[model samples]
Target: MWGKSTAAVFLGMPLSVLVVGFAALLSHDQASTTLPWLLLFFLVWIAVMTCTFLFRTGLRAWLWMGGLTIAGYAALHFLKASGLVRIAA
Candidate 1:
């Protein structure tokens, strides 16, 4: 369905980024982060894409994934701001 496809492309992308970014933040070994995160992004993205179809409608998919992505990003931001987690540049 077109709705699922759009959700997979739009919502899934940012959600994957947030997942990988948070994971990378938690990792203390920043030296070897990039490659692993790159790999993780694909895995997370595939999972997210598949999960989108579980919703009954495209709008539902967008709402849930969007909300989830927002929540995850907020938590990630909080952790970074509180100095509980940090990503090495």
Candidate 2:
């Protein structure tokens, strides 16, 4: 019961958002290429990451970071699949 507690789910959410947003913003630039959605996403993610930190739970933090890594991989897969990104394959 403790391992899958509401706290872990809640705590992981923010960190995931923050990390995803960071990836989005870092992936693109140029005023015209800039997207409001991306910016919003970034801010939301930062907020989430902040909240996770506030929880100060070591297990939650570790899980959050793990989820973040998975999310990053998923994003990369999407980008590659869409042909928006190339990995020299």
Best by lDDT: 1
For each candidate, give its TM-score against the true structure.
Answer: 0.82, 0.38
Q: 1-89, model 1: which lDDT tens digit per residue?
A: 78877988899989989888777767778769867888878888899899889889888888888899899989988888998876676
Model 2: lowest-lDDT 10 consecutive positions? 25-34
lDDT of 2 by residue, 1-89 (tens): 34434444554565555455545445545333336545566466556555555545657665766666678768766876887764321
The lDDT per prediction is: 0.85, 0.56
Q: What lDDT score goes with residue 45 in model 1?
A: 89
Which candidate should be chosen as best, given TM-score against the real structure? Answer: 1
| Local distance difference test, candidate 2 | 0.56
Count of steric clashes across candidates, in order: 0, 3
